[model samples]
Target chain A: MGVNTSGAAAYWNLERYAERVAFVDEQGGICRYGQLQSQVDEFRDQLPQKRQLMVMVSRQTVPSLVAYLGLLQAGHPFLLLDEKTPAEQRADFIERFRPARLIDATGQTIESTLLDSGLDENPTALVEDLALLLPTSGSSGVAKWVMLSYDNLQSNAASICEYQAIVPEDRAITSLPMAYSYGLSVINTHLLAGASLALSSASMMERPFWEQLREQSVTHLAAVPFQYELMERLRFRQQDWPALRLLTQAGGRLSETLAKAYTRYACEQGKQFFLMYGQTEATARMAYLAAHREPEKVPAIGRAIPGGQILLADTEGELVTQAGQPGEIRYRGPNVMLGYARTAQDLVAPERPQELATGDLAVLDESGVYRVTGRLSRILKMQGRRIDLDDLQHTLAAEGWSLLVTGEDDRLLVCLTPGQNSEALLQSLAGHTGIHRAYCHVFERDAFPLTPNGKPDYAQLKRMQHESAA
Target chain B: MKAENQILNTLFTQSLGIPSDLVTEDLAYNSLPQWDSTAHLQLVMALENHFGITLETEDMLDMSSVAKARSILEKYGVEWV
Candidate 1:
């Protein structure tokens, strides 16, 4: 149960618990721990050594996990591309990463001029060796690949398992995209603990999704805030999912109302609801709210997982120890990534061995709970005024309104649910924040656009806003 | 007169939620504002439904630009003039 010194060795140890279930894909196919290991070995034998491989997979599929494990076992650094990424983006990725080969189960077959190198017969990676190159979700703009090591992933998985008290037989459902750090972490931690995974390709809105969860007896569910919004819209009742035992949400803040509602439902159902917060840089989860305490202390992202330390520092980088004071959330842990990948130059020099200065602004409450305010980089300056779009959106969301804010050509546009008084909402926001009306414009839509990962599609939103303004 | 062009026009308009007039043979998917990943999936489904043929995954990925889409559809036996 100590920190795994090697990815392959850790997996080998976990395979001893191979009699336990490992994964159940959307097609109801079951992969036991032993079977998963065999597939990983098989995939490793099929891969080339010392060359980059691009894994293109649907979110939460068994093949995706197998491919990742295989790449690690073979000591080949791999890039994970979400199936939902456009072909244009994939082409761009192929060119930039120059992956020697691509493995896809999503049926995407790309032919590129990139060199195809032969596979290695025997390859191995140490715990400290690079394991993966994951691209940041980049909901804002251009995506950057974050380099992660085997030790980074192993430490984070072990810490998560320790925090959750995950057991061998626990069953988890794959809800988020596996290409995402949050979703991939769920697989790594669960499998590390010899748990079972139920994969369902259906979206949250689909009828088959809930039915599959109930049928598969999914004990753990990982989701983002948008899916929780859909669950609320569906008015999912506690009695409907008696088999559900734990629910975790991350990848953006869950609204206070939905959090309270889900917490109450979990409480009534005698299930645990975990409010988790993390980023790709941390290799998944850094902080999690314990399941027993929900709704009453809802906004907090809870405490750090084992082996991780979260400290808040003011704008000047001085550590803030006082509760309720906002500062940049800096993380120091083995799980923090090495650094980001640069297209033009060699990888940026790694940050000081253990600490990562997360760009998020947050506060630690009296209970030692962390609540993210906004990203420091997300702040926009327009017409001599500074604005935090996240703050503006959060304020509107608190009042039962949903909006996506973007700036195009020096004009800030607020995209909200259609037919609501756009001007009035803007006026109210201005009244509350003292923002000038001329600098802000409001556009209404029936539904705000969302990425496949369930985050707001700000890139697409900005484009639309620009076209409309033109 | 080409089935490939018809497929492209229909998919572009229907999936991207753009007017038919806006879709041209030279119009790239990302060049238009509304044609994003989500819309791309919708476009794929539309193509499958319209052609009554299951698109190979490779072809689906290759259908990025309108011209690329026409070529891919031609491989599927949909003729393009």
Candidate 2:
């Protein structure tokens, strides 16, 4: 079984793994590599022969996995969107991008009307290297997509396999949405390593998710900070699933308290715990704290991954040579995205070397590990999903509410003037923004505190959150 | 509604930001968009605070619906009217 070792090599040569298990269904049925290749081939044959753009409603299902490989193998660069995306948002993307086809979660493919009308008749107009497009902001209803090439995917996958030392025997259970870069990386890196995956959409809150984890003998598990919180609440330490070996965390910073707790568990149980950091711009991960570093660097996001460099530069664009000085974390790597795409025409934008400015503030420890201090942007991640506060504020203002939105990683606090209905406003914000109402809190004040420049004093607002929360 | 049901209803309404009338016994986790995983966590925290009892992992995971929640609460000595 010689590896293809070329562009998009994983999907291009699924047969190389032969009878090894590729996917474990929710019911614990195994689909070997040979059968998976056949399924991808059948699906590829059904797709349009010409290279084109497609939109796929992605789920952590085996059929969706098959469609993904089929699309990649057929050379169709598709946009992967969450199944929970609003119908209006999907329709808006369709109207703006005019994708040639739409593949629903059930693996049903529907050709667009534009395909028959001869609009943009040549699909090859897109950049030859473009392989996938992922939405930059899922909750904001923004249509900006991160354009990724086959090289970007391959390099990142290979790098991840190198650090994690994933083997053919590892079986990962999908706990995150495949639409997300972190989740998609789990699929890509595992398949590239000839490892098997258990496709389950059940969340950590559900008993079935744990049942499947034990049933499938899943070895590798990936989660975000919020999911780690849930696993804590779920008393993951009490579980006796012996096969669980590797645990990876990303998507956002895990609180120091939780990080230490997991580190202790991994040490006691003799398992690996990796605290990683990345943005969608860098494919999936740029750095991970090696497990051997342990309790000493429990919360630090360790060194840059293989084939990548993690550098910190101050706001003046000078490298911060001294330790303990915070700077914007930057990553230069082959996994950097081709660029961003706001329109269909932007897909053809030429490729160039990219260095991702990760808009995050972190300081270097004496040992060269990076400890993230805070965010440079007005964004917060609740339940592993990034929410842009500015975008959310605009959405609220459009609906006749002007308030100060500020919060930590776990919750969103909005300061409102008195006489506003807090419950109604919170409900509307959650419903419109797809942020759960539980994470949205409201505080009332006669007038908001202002900075010297008359801008809403975000520092004061954040202070108010503690007083109100207590 | 019984006093127990009323207390439960108030907690669900305030925590989930849903109307009290929608918090019926048949209301289940993941059934209402508001009663999602995050909301469920909030509800559990609220229950622990109100009942003054920490729920174990099995107790939390087994609490799937309003009816199931009441039964689980009873195990912690919460009485129903």
Candidate 3:
């Protein structure tokens, strides 16, 4: 997709990283960067049209990536639908995007929905500067598209590689979904650095995942918090991976306990654990706490990534420079997304401001680290006092409990794991807040509802809480 | 044998947190969303707790389907019908 001239040039040179092992598939198929560029060239040649907006359902990592590059080469602004999106939601997105073509993993057009002659009178002109469109979950729990230019993708990849100290020798695995920005970032960074990747769609819950990791000898893998929880439940440390050198976590807040536990486990296994923080608006990563830091630093999102700057802004929009003061996180970087798009017309607009007001509230410590206190919306008013649910959840998670918190105006409801009995925690929560035990309730669930991006689905939890209360 | 079937049936449903009606003899791991890797571990734990026998890692890997679980448990003297 043709973007601003400087941004377009950044993406135009594909052969710069044309030779290196990109990754191995489950069937022992190896993909190289050179081969990847060649595949993109081949696929672009076979494309039915040029510079058309296409919606694609990703398949296995390698194939999905090839088509992604193919779209870039063909100058088509593409929307990558989450592979895990349910059929109904998938239908909703396809209907909304109104792409010229809907392509499956195998590069086959599922169907052609040719728009009216006047719709996007110049199809390619619509995205002359936009290259990627990612789905972001809005505050009200709806999927909204975020527009990213070629600069956003390349700069983010370069910035990630810098902080992570990724090299051509690194072998990262596809532990996360390719459709999501984090997973896609891993692929991009590795390919950009002439490194390698190991692709498997099998989840951490399956045995094949372990088998594939062992056979391929992946040097690193990225995971969200819940995937770490699942691994902990399965006694992940019981097995050793001699080949693993790094473990990265992001997508949501990982509890201090889990973070420390994994950090220790990685240390024991002679590996580094990277705790990262990001949003799709920032193109996946904003900050990352590296492995060599002290254990206390594990809870902090560390500093902004190499090229990015983090500043705290209060309600009046003044910068808060004093340490220990909490305010909204404001991030400034080239990796920030161009803008957001709720409708197709929005895709054609110019870039948004490079500064992102990351709605997460954070306090900067004396050590130049940013510790997220809670989201601006996560504060709860209880018994004439304000309580941050993120704080409550953090405390609970730090105490080795898997949980979610929801509430009404007058009461609070906390949900824990089905097998865990939190009677003591429940009693303490009631007493600590001066709220009567009757006003606070504790329940359990087998699993918390997760959004398509794998974070806890607060919308679903709220519905369930009210439905049960009623 | 009847007692063993009763025990296994209870174990599968309870461990996987699925309805008893859904725990058919042919029900396999990964067949249902609920029967994931964690559920498999839970099932193994329930089997160990109920039968008073520990399974090797290979046996755990082999325990993908209910029939396979039954067969493995029988080796540990579960005597399922």
Q: Interface RMSD (Å), each candidate?
A: 12.8, 1.4, 8.6
lDDT tens per residue, model 2, A1-470: 11123543654468789789999898888899999999888887778766778889989997799998888777788889988777889888887778888999988899857633133466557777788888877555775788888878888999999999999999999999999999999999999999999999877888888889998899999999888888888879777769999999998888889888888888888899999998888998899997544568878999899999989999999999799999999899998999988878787665555688888899998888898888888887766677888888888888888688887877788999888888789778777566777677898888898999998788799897788778
Q: Higher-lDDT candidate among 1 and 3?
A: 3
**Which consecutive 10 residues in model 3 chain A have the weakest lDDT in total?**
A110-119
Please give the range of 10 consecutive residues that has the lowest summed lDDT in model 1 chain A.
Answer: A118-127
What is residue A10's positional error in candidate 2, in angstroms? 3.4
TM values, all candidates: 0.68, 0.94, 0.77
Candidate rank order under TM-score: 2, 3, 1
Local accuracy of candidate 3 as per-residue lDDT tens digits, B15-48: 7766689988799877876676556766877888
DockQ of each: 0.03, 0.64, 0.28
* Model 3 / residue A421 / CA error / Å: 22
Query: For residues B17-44, could you state the per-residue lDDT of candidate 1 as single tens digits?
Result: 6678988777765565466444565676
True contacts kept of each: 0.00, 0.62, 0.14
| CAPRI tier of model 1 | incorrect
lDDT of 3 by residue, A1-470 (tens): 34434443343345776666766888888876677788777777656564667788886566677788777666677788756555766666666667777777777655454532123567755757687788764111246788887778888898998887888898888887677788888888887677787888886756787888889988878887656765776577788788888889887777678888988887777778899988888888999888555566777888899889999999999999999999999999988888887667777665688699877889998889889887667755443234556666776676677889766545678877777767676655643443444457777678898999999887688787777768
Best by TM-score: 2
Top candidate by DockQ: 2
Docking class of 3: acceptable
Best by lDDT: 2
